[model samples]
Target: MARSARPVVHYMATRPDGTVPPTCNHLARYYSGLGETIPTVNLADHIGETVDHPSPGEKWYTDKPFSYFHMYTRPGEILERLEVEERWPVRLWEVEPLGETGNWGNDFAPYWLMSHQIRVVREVEAWRAFGHRGMQVLATLAQLPDLARQWTEEWTADPEGTRRTYTAWEKRVDHTRALTGWAFCRAQYSRREAGLQAANELAGNAAAQAATAAGADPHAVALIQLRARCLVAGQLMFDRIRTGEYEQSIRGLLLGAGLETPAPALA
Candidate 1:
C-alpha cells in the first residue's frame, strides 16, 4: 500500500516592500528539491478567507504553525526588530543574549519542544480521539491511580527487566531533550521551582498517607510521585507556548523527573 502523503504548507516572508524575501525563495527551492509542493498565494487574493472561513492553505498552516519558522527568518532577528521598533517592548536579551552559534536563546528550544514531547502529546491526543491504541501508554497513565503499585509488582517480578523498561520509558519522556537555558531565566525559573515543589509535596503526601493504604513499594511510590511532578511540568509547558517563559515549563518537568540539569546544553 502507498504511504499517505504529508500535508503541504505554504508561507512567505515579506520584505519592507511587501515582496518575498530571499529567505522565503530559498525555502520554496528547498522544498521543491525535496519533491514537496508549496503553493504561492497573495494575501490580497486570499482576503476572502477569514478565520471562520479559512481556505485549505489557512487550515493547514493553522494545524502546523511551526511551518512559519521552518521557512521563515531567524527568531532572534524577528524579536530584535520588534525591540528596535519598540512595538515588542519585551527585551529577551535582558534575560539572555541571542547568540549567533547553535546557541540556547536563538530558536533551539521551541523547535526541540515542538519536535519532541509536544508533538508526542498531540499525536497521543489524536490517537485517543480516534480510538486507537497508539497512545495507550499515556491513556494508561491517566487511568491508573496507583501507578506505583503497578510498577512495584513489575519490578518485584523482574528486577533487571523492570529497571531497563522504566529507564527507557523515562528517557522517552525526558524533558531536557526539548528544553534549554532559556527555561532557566530568573523569573521563569522561580515558577518552575514552585511547580517542582508542589509535585514533591504531592508525592510526599501520597507516600505518607496512601503508600501502604495502596500497597505500593517504596521505590515504585517514588516513581509515581515523579510522574505526578512530570504532569505538573507538562501542563506548565503547554501554557507558555509562545512566550519568553516557555522553556521553564520543560525545565520544571526535567526537575520533577529527578534530572539534575538540562541535558548538558546540547554540546
Candidate 2:
C-alpha cells in the first residue's frame, strides 16, 4: 500500500482574540523565504474549500490552515480549552505537516537549530536587545545597597539637608526598581537610621551569597547573574510575543528602563 498524498495546506496560529501574533508573522516571513507566500484567509470565507467551517468555539482556527504551525497565542489557555471543551481529535485528513508545531517561545534554542542562512535574524536581534537592556537594569539594581550606604554616611555628616536629599534619592531608586520588577529591597523604612542599617546588612549578605555561589571573583559572579537575568527576560519577552502582546511587552521594557517608546517604523 502507498501512503496518501499529503495535503498542500498551510496552517498559522492566531491569538485568542483572532489577531495574528508576531510569532506567526515571523514564521510566515520565514516561510516566504521558501518561495511560497501563504496568504491569510478566513475559514468563513474559505468554506467548502477542503474542510468545513470551524465552529464558534473553534475561533482559534480563524485564518488557520491544516499545517503543524497551530496555536500561536495563549497556547496554554487554548490547550486547556481543547482538553476541557472536548475540542481535540481535530480533523487532519487533508492537512500537511510542515515543521515542528505547537507552543513555541519557551526556549530559543530550537529557532537557531535551522540553517543559519534561513534563520530569522530579526528575532535574534530583538532577543539581543532585550537581554542587553535587562543586564543594564540588573547591574544598577545590584549597586543600590552600596549607594544606600554612601547616602547614609552623607546623612550622618549633614543630617538636616542630607535627609531631604537622601529621601529623594531613595524614592528614585524605589521607582526604578518597581518599574523594572526588581523590588526585592524596597524602601519601607520610615526612619533614615533604620533604612541605612537595613540596607547595609542586606548588601553585605547579598555580596557574600553571590561570592559563595560562584566560588570565584565577585565581579565574575556579578556578570554571571546579569547574564542569567538577561536570558530569562529575553525568554519571557519571546513568550509574550507568542501570546500576541508584542507592544505591551516591548513598551513595558522601554518604560522600565527610563527610555522613550519610539514611533513604529514604516512597514
Candidate 3:
C-alpha cells in the first residue's frame, strides 16, 4: 500500500566562537527521535542562506532552517536505504554522516528563518521532525509578544501611582517572555534526557538487566538517564543561545518593558 512520510527535519548550528544557543542543526537532529537519519551542518560550513537555489546574488546572510523532504514519502526510509546501499555500519552513527548525491547525502535545512531576526511560523511542516517534542510543545512560546502583553497587564495592575515603578507594563511583559523562553528550554532538554537514557540502556543491556533483576535502586537508572540528557540538551540550548535570535527579541521586549532579562544559564 502506501508508505509513511518521514517527518521534515529542523537542524540547529553550533558556532566556532563558542556561545550559548537555543537552536541548532545538532539539536534538531538529536531531538527529532528519528535517529541516524537527519543530517547536521556547522556554522562554518554554511556559506549562507539561499532562497533561489544558487542563492540569488548576494547570498543573504540570513539563516534559514533547512532539511530534505520528498514530495510524499517518509525520510526515514530513504535514510535506511542509504545505510544498506552504502553499507556504512559504524560510521552511520556519527553525528555527521556523509554521502551526498551519489551515495545520498543527508539533507540539511534551517528550523526557522532569520533575516533581521527570528520569524515564527507555526504552520511550518517540520515542527515535529526533531523528535516528537521540543520547545515547540510549550504553549506559551508560540507568541512572545502577546504572551508578554498579557503578563504585564495582570502583574502590575496596581503599582504605585508613579508610572516609573519597576512594575511598568514593559517590565512585566519582558519578564513573561523571558520566563516563557526559559521554560521552553527546560522542557526541550527533558526530551533529550529520555533519549539518552534509552540509548544508554541499549548500550548497556546487561547492566540494565542486572539492575532490573537485582532491584538495586530502580531509580538509579533514572538519574543516569537524566544526567546524560541534560548534558546534551544543555549543549543544544547553548547553541541556540549563540544565535541570539530568540534571546535578542526577549531582551528587546524587556528593554521596552523596563525589565532586565537575565542571561541564559547555558552552563
Candidate 4:
C-alpha cells in the first residue's frame, strides 16, 4: 500500500521494565488502511528463490545490510519470510564495516532490523492493503533454531567444519553460533554469571582483533565493548576447566572441535 504520503508516527519497542500508557487504542492504526504484508522489494524477482540462499552475480560488500545478511541466510528470501513473518528468530549480529569489505549499507540496510524480523510496522492499514495485493504474509515469526542453522552453514573457502566450528576466527564473525551455544550452556549450567561472562569474552575475541585499541571502528568497538561488558567469558570458560566450576561445555568444545580446550588462561 502506498503510504497516503501522510506523516507517520513510529515508536521504539516497549522495554523490559518500562511502562507505556495503553491509551493508543489502535496499536496498528498506522497500517489500518494499508495492505497486510507489504513486500518492500520486487516479489516476482524473488519467486522460486531459496530463502536461505543469495542471488548470483550479486556481490555483497561487508557493509551493514549485506554483512548482516551473510551472518544468516539469503537476504531476499529472508525478506520474503519477513513479508510473511515466517522467519526463524536468531540472535542479532553486529553490523559489518564498509570501506574495503563491501558497501552493504546502501543495498542491505541491515541496521534497520530489530531481531530477526524487520520490526518497524508499516501501519496496520498498510499491511491490510499489502494483504490485498495477493501477498501471502505469514503472521507467525520463525523459530530461533531455524535461523541459527542457517547461520551455522556460512559459505567460505575454508575447509568443512573449519569455519563452521564455534572457535576458528573470522574478521566479521557469525554472532549467532556463539550466542546460541552460550545460551544453551547458560541454561544447562548452574553458573549464570560464569557462563554469560565466558560466552561474551568468546564473542568479543571473535568479533575483533583488539580490545583497547584507540583507532577501532564502530564494528570493532562493539566487540571490544562486548568483551568489557560481559566481564569474562573466555576467563570463565578457562577458569572452569582449570578449577572445574562447570567443565561440560568446555570439555564438549574440546572434544567437539578436536582442539584441546586450553586449561591454560583463555587468550
Candidate 5:
C-alpha cells in the first residue's frame, strides 16, 4: 500500500529583513531573495475588485505558501534519524524544532525558524498547549499596520479620501490584505485561548488531586507550576533575543510588507 505524505508545517519565510533568511538548504533555495507582493485578488477570486492598473512587476508573487508542501520530515523523525546517523545529534524535546530538510549542518534550521516565525501545521492540538500560558495571540494582528508603517513610508501614502491614484490603490490593497491576515490570526487566537483554558482546567484538577494525595497544599502546588512555566517561557524569549532571531524576524516582517528598509523594533 502507498503511504500518505507527511503532514506539513507552515511558516512565513520572509523576515522583516530584506536579506535571505537563514534556513534549510532546500527552503533557502526555494525562497532566497524572494519578496511577497501584496496580493491583489482574494483567494476565492470570485469577488471583483477596483482596479488602479499597477504594473505587473510591482506585484511580486512568492511561493512561500506552497513551499510547505515540499517539507516531509517532522521533528521526531529528524532527531531520530540524526541520532542514528551520529551526525549533529540533538535532543528532540530539548532543542527547539522547526520543519526542514533532514540534512547535517542544517540541524539548527528548524529551531531558528521556530524561534523567529515558524508555525507547525500538524498537531493541531498544540494550540491548546500555548493557551495555558495566557498568551495574547491577537496582538500580532493588532500590530500589523504599525509594523507596516514602521517598515514602509508608502504604507500610509493614501488616506481614505485620496483620489484613485496608484498610491491610493496600493494602500487600499494593503488594507484588504491586512484584514484577511487579521481574520485568520483572530480565529487562531480564539481557538488557542479556548484550548488553553480547557487543558489547564484538566491539568490543574489532576495536579490538585495528586498534591492532596501526597498531603501537600494543592494551591501552593498549582502556584509553583505557574511560576515554573513563566520562568521557562521567559528563558526562551531571552534565548531568542541573544540569538538575534528576534531582531531578524522583526526586520523580515517589515521587508515582506514592502514598507521600507530597517524597521525599528517596538520598545
Candidate 6:
C-alpha cells in the first residue's frame, strides 16, 4: 500500500531575540516528540511568488506523519502517547486543563469569535425588549414627546458615565436609535393627525349641511363628528408607531440634547 501523505502545519517561530508565543514551542515540541522535524521559512522569500505566502514569524512542518486520519485509525493512541510523554495528563472531566493548546497566543481566536457573536445576539435581544417596553408605555400619542424629553434628560445628565456603564457598542447605538425612533414617531403622528383632521373636518361640514337640509338632528351629527376624530387619532398614532420613518438622526439628536456622540468600544 502507498504511504499516506504527511500533514503540514505551521506555527510562529521563536525570534532571534528569543521571544516567541508560548504555544509555538509547545506545539513544535509535541510534533517533534511524535518523530517529526519542523522547518522554518522566511516569508520575504515567497512574498512575490505566491498570493498565499507565509506570514512573518511562521514556521512550517512538512515531515509530520500524524494526521486526522491517523487519529481515527488507532483511537486512544495519540492520547496515550501524550500521557506517556508527560506532556498532557489524561483527565476525563477537564478540557484544556493545561491551558490553551493552539499555536496562537493566550487570546484564542475561536473563543474570541464565539464571544463576539454571543454579545451581538444578547444586544439584539435587549433591543427587542426595549421596543416592547416602549409600546407598552406609549399609550397615548401625547406621551411620545414627553418620553423623548425624558430620555434626553437621562442621557445628558450622565453621558460619559452611561457610555462607560454600557460598554458594548451595540448597546450605545441602540440607545441613540431608540431615541431617534421616538422622535420620528412623534413627528409622523403629528403630521398624519393634522392631515386626517383636515379631511375629517371637510367631510363633517358637508355631512352637517346635508343633515340640516334633511332636517336631521344637529346634536347627533356633532357626536358622530367627535367619534370620527377620536377614532382617526387613535388609529393614526398606532400606525405611525408601527411604521415610522426610522432614519439616522443620531448625530442631530445627540447634539441637540447636549450629549456627546458615543465613542466606539476598544477592542
lDDT per model, in order? 0.34, 0.30, 0.29, 0.28, 0.28, 0.30
TM-score for candidate 6, residues paired by index: 0.18
Could you give candidate 4's per-residue lDDT for residues 145-202 as a string of tens digits? 2322233223122224432232333221233333345533642342233224333333
- The alpha-carbon lDDT assigned to residue 201 of candidate 5 equals 37
How many steric overlaps does candidate 6 have?
0
Provide the TM-score for each candidate, comma-separated: 0.29, 0.22, 0.20, 0.20, 0.19, 0.18
lDDT tens digits, residue span 17-92, model 1: 2221221345555767888765432223322232111112221132321222222122222211111222122211
lDDT at 36 for candidate 4? 36
lDDT of 3 by residue, 130-246 (tens): 233333322212333243333234323522322233334334443554433542354334333222222223323333343334343434333222222222333223334334676
lDDT (10s digit) by residue, model 6, range 80-195: 22312222211111001111122223342211100000000000111111122222212322233333344334434665553443343334434755333443345333432222
TM-score, cand. 4 = 0.20
Q: Is candidate 3 or candidate 5 better by TM-score?
A: 3
lDDT of 4 at 262: 20
Q: How many steric clashes does model 3 contain? A: 35
Candidate 5: 10-residue stretch with minimal lDDT: 87-96
Q: In model 1, which range of ten residues has the least summed lDDT?
A: 115-124
Better of 2 and 3 by lDDT: 2
Between candidates 2 and 3, name the one with more favorable TM-score.
2
Off by over 4 Å in 4: 1-176, 182-188, 193-213, 226-231, 239-267
RMSD of each: 19.8, 21.1, 20.5, 21.4, 24.4, 28.2
The alpha-carbon lDDT assigned to residue 185 of candidate 1 equals: 35
Off by over 4 Å in 3: 1-124, 135-139, 160-267
Q: Give the alpha carbon lDDT tens digit for every residue of 99-121 in model 2.
A: 33333244622211111011111
